[model samples]
Target: MSAIVNRLAPANAVVPEQQPSAVAGLRLETRIVDGAEWDRTIAGFDEVCQEQLHVFATARWPSVKQEPMLFLADGQVVGGSLMMVQPLPLRIGHIAVSKWGPMLKDSSAPHAAALRDAMVEALIADYAERRGLMLSVLPRAALETDNSAYERLLARGFKRGSELGFPSRYIVRLGLSDAEQRKSLQQKWRYHLNKSEKAGLSFEHAGPERMGEFDRLYAAMSERKQFPDHSAYDTVPLLMALDIETLRPELFFVRHAGEVVAGALIFKAGDRAVYLYGATNDTALPLRAGYFMHWQIIRWLRDNTRAGWYDLGGTDGFHGLHQFKKGMVGEAGVITPVPPVANYAARPWAYLLGNGAFWARDAAYHIRRVVTGALRPKARPDQAPVVVEAGQP
Candidate 1:
């Protein structure tokens, strides 16, 4: 018997609510992308915005055995869908999952709704025809207060699943002039920047050729702290490969005695720039290199890029990290959830078991940390200069 059978009986056993054949007075167009073309389509989309969904698809598409579809309406591309066929170890058939992600454009318009409905219908038909998937998971971006998409999904018989954690991106408006920008900073932040400058710290831009230095500084910091290993740093070759791509690496390096002491990596996409990575040398603590590096990047974005915002990505919910980001100019924005799906035969059991397992693991982790005092590590002063170099631009 399939593990799914041992888990939950097929979804068919549970009758679902009937949904309207159309929604929001719009029609959608959906098609499948297979083979090598999937990568190209994903890469093309990445040029517009580097959302995690696109990145995940790009990285895992080859192995995921998924098909991509683009939704169109009135000859304009409105949204897209990705369906993955997953075959479990003990399952007899593949489970199909369709994520309602990486929305190409605004989904609020009446036309957009029609397009979405059509796209979703096409996806369902495709799955049913392709030997039919056991279930589909769709997650939409929580771009606005309206939960129209969620309601529509519910109407179509999809159940609410686990809430996925997303980075609360901090956006700093960049239209302000230099003086205005400085004034906009929280008084303490401004004071620190000025103090760092007065303490003899200088900043410079780094490129691909200087990546080795950046890696060394990052490795040193990681060794000193209990943080997840950043894939970019662990895989230098991947970072170098990105250098050949279109990502603009605006790496700011703080220097003392003509040596790198700290650095921040800012990645530009369209009118926005994101603070992707940073590292510093322990010996350069007095100069407040990290503060200077951040300030320098903000200034650079303000003056040159004319970019609208600088994103300080990721925070541990409303914790200290979130507070630091909140201190910046823009307000916090939430990302939508990315849905997951298991086989219909396993869906019910998986839902119950997954939630229980998640809480249990979290509780154990907390207890272990509390007992070991692992959660209360003393904050280390930033010291370390990051060297910056880049490949031929």
Candidate 2:
């Protein structure tokens, strides 16, 4: 397929400066629908999320049938949440999961508590009518403390789980303007950024037409890093298509010399922008193209948009990558806890078994990678493709 390329604005084109805004009110709503409806909802949500950095837009519940309940306030759709159920065999039961929201604005604890109450009430009402739903799980965004908002939910009968499954690194705030951003970075990172700039690295916005460049870079990294599954790269086309069709090209950026060498995929949900996917040529490491790419993207958002937090996604708590992201800027947010649903009713049991089977199927992915690597010879470096799909790079 021919790639879609967006023209870059002329160097002299005027780019407006960004200004910060205060928080706004909160509102809530719910929409229940089947697969088609869910898909449409997700697409719409994706557009908003890509611009806003809200987490609810990215969270997918495993279910053939789904109902998305959204939260709005002050006339703006601030949150997208849902209740999902998965079917199981032998009449055991179904699994239920609901999220309150990717609460956009930071509100007072009382206001947040009220929103949680309303969402939980809606969930209970929906759950009570369903026979197969044995247990319901809600993965809320992490908060800093045991406050009234959380306390209210627990008081309302929801129990805290022992484990936090969806723990995300907290928001890192890199100030607007390249100079200010550079000043905020640690001395060593700043040194690398300077070195990268001296190497003649530059960044550009990417679109569908240039997706091939992204794909090539991503595939090269995947092979070198020995990534366990190719699906991470496979999802590129879909995500890029989604980005373009939704008019959110700011979600993607590429760094290059005369040709693309490294890139990253970013997603904005609300006031948050997430650093999602990235890949670079190992040859570009010394130039620190990755560092330059990240620095530029963060500066753009900080200067041109209302985004407040940049999520580096997930990482091994103590890994080098995690530490690198930490050094970028911003305080860490709460770790998302994923607790098992406690209900053991037959319906729930069936759902778990079936879902577990699906999980096992996914787990086999690493083994497949191992076999594929062992059987297929590596492509010669000289024969590497010039362009690849979008998100992969």
Candidate 3:
């Protein structure tokens, strides 16, 4: 799941709650649209990510409004952005969020670094530098980690957010042989995978035909656990409609005895697969169904499909969620963080609200768990589990 952070509270669904900030200074031209052309414009950029797609924006902003923003230098496109602007659930003012984007590059140009710098400078002067509205961006980790990109973003006033979630994705390279891949996993993870194998759980590619099953398991898990659910945006209908070869949403489950106990839904785009959503029955927790599902998917991506990379999703503190990924993918897997420099500082109130909302959300989670007597899952013998999502690990 994508770590969500910002949106704008539009007064009416059709127009911006805050008036559009006028463009000034420099010869940079700008255009914002809510059309099919956004997809065509961003096609084939080095920074391509699923969240940057037009259909993804549609899935995400089903209830809110979204605009695709472009920065043009002379007659050429310098930067492209997709913003999901909407109010928070409780009527607090809105916040705007941009994830793994504004594809900051010029495909047809020379000196990509120089062009990107110029485009970002204009982007800063245009959007982030102006008002104090609630705006947060989780740029490509490649951009945030590089010395030049890191320095430029900080100079523009983006404060890093959390180390977990959108800031970083846990990625495992799939170029290794099966034995090497198994070795990369933590020792215990391998043992557990073997143990789960003895349980004889079966794997099935239950795509869109099982959407309701995926939805019900997902919703149940969301309520029983504390992980954020942006799966609402990347719904079954949208995923099922996509071409299976270029991009496919896959569902794999672990069936024990005769019943389905755990499942995962992942998206394969190009040569990469990202875990989008997953579910498990609490009663079957000890069976390590989640482990089976994840391992099977990783193996499948490596052996059965063209996908050469597998993203095990993001961190959730040290909770079962993060620990599970770490155990399965091990140290060789890279964790991609959104980085603080790209989280552009929010308006003071918006900052407070964002943090407040986060704290309150966690607070409610703990309270509910206590009321429900839900014990936290033990991650391993060496550490204490982060009590965020009990069922997730």
Candidate 4:
């Protein structure tokens, strides 16, 4: 009863003989799809990221046009991305952005490298060479290291930019046994976790109806910290309201003295589960509710989901927050994302004008941030137990 269907290329289809070895037997297809179908198709993939989901993209970029792209080899769908297309100023062309995607059915497969290369080449051909748009791709944070996909992108003339999709983050590897996972925590972190367990706190898997309560907690925390509200609060409700199971977030709450003290929202897609937003009130710090809340989350992910890694999100520039996350991630889980890369239009003038305008916009954005004091780093209270909600820094 699944909506996904595999379509073969026409009999007269031309093979990409001149392209890289990976491009052979690989075909990329684009289709206009409804929301249900889009969700169904992508959900079937092995690694689905929130950014590549229909609900997230529609909520995150309401104005930009979204296109669904599918990758196939030997007539079977293997990978795809929900691409966001933005028109350049003065009608120069367009900028196609793909964030944290195109997800594959099995990134660990033997043919993954070649499939990824073919996807990159197809992306360039469709967006840059044929349609004459700038194709900008920001791979998932985990792909930041000596990734073959990134190297392939550079080999195909994609220019690397300083903009990163994710800053340095901490991810807990969930493959460890429960005892080992706890032991992996820093000595102090484990001590506090034990203390929190004895503090008479309770944990619950909150339902979508509790989103209003979460928003209230988040709003109060943002006001108290005087920091920017980077949580996905605006989009959480919409995603929660959807029928699509892949995009629904898992909400965990901690209660002390019969009152909610802390809560964390996590989204799982593919093999990774990410901490989207977390909040704690003043009462939470005293009870060490944050520690209790995260421990429960870790245990839940390990017991329930197929996810192998849990991202703790970013810490921005807060020292205490960074230390707390580092303790949770241990030494081996810290990761710095690769910077975004862009493939420009085939025409020289279009590339120059388009690149110039994009930089101009970036400069203005930084100026605005400076004027608004958004770049100022606030010191986290030494005893603060949990990280606030985070997004791209």
Model 4: lowest-lDDT 10 consecutive positions: 384-393
Please state the error at residue 350 of candidate 3 in Å: 12
Where is model 3 more than 4 Å wrong at Cα?
1-33, 39-46, 62-64, 70-79, 85-97, 104-115, 128-135, 142-148, 156-168, 219-234, 242-248, 270-272, 303-308, 341-393
lDDT (10s digit) by residue, model 2, range 256-298? 5576678887765445566767888876787788778888888
If scored against the real structure, what TM-score would every candidate get? 0.65, 0.66, 0.66, 0.86
Off by over 4 Å in 4: 1-24, 30-32, 143-145, 374-393
lDDT of 3: 0.60
Error of 4 at 235 (Å): 1.1
Deviation in angstroms for 377 in model 3? Answer: 12
| Ordered list by lDDT, greatest first | 4, 3, 1, 2
Looking at candidate 1, the ten consecutive residues that score lowest on lDDT are 1-10
lDDT of 4 by residue, 1-393 (tens): 333434433432223344354445555554445566777777756678777877777877787788877776655677877778877777666788778766787877865766766666666667776677777777766533455566566766677764622356677778778788887788898888999999999999988889888888988988887876544568888778867676688888999988998998898766888898899999999788988998889889888888888888666545677778878876435444444555446677666766776787778856655554645445222333332222221
Query: After superposition, which runs of candidate 1 have C-alpha atoms over 4 Å from their true positions?
Result: 1-25, 34-63, 74-76, 81-100, 105-158, 164-167, 230-236, 243-245, 248-250, 270-272, 302-307, 317-320, 330-393
Backbone Cα, N, C clashes tallied per candidate: 24, 34, 14, 0
Please give the RMSD of candidate 1 to the true structure.
9.7
Candidate 1 per-residue lDDT over residues 125-166, each given as its tens digit: 455433545555544333344445555656665555444343
Clashing pairs in 4: none
Model 2 TM-score (2 dp): 0.66
Model with the higher lDDT, candidate 2 or 4? 4
Model 1 vs. true fold: TM: 0.65
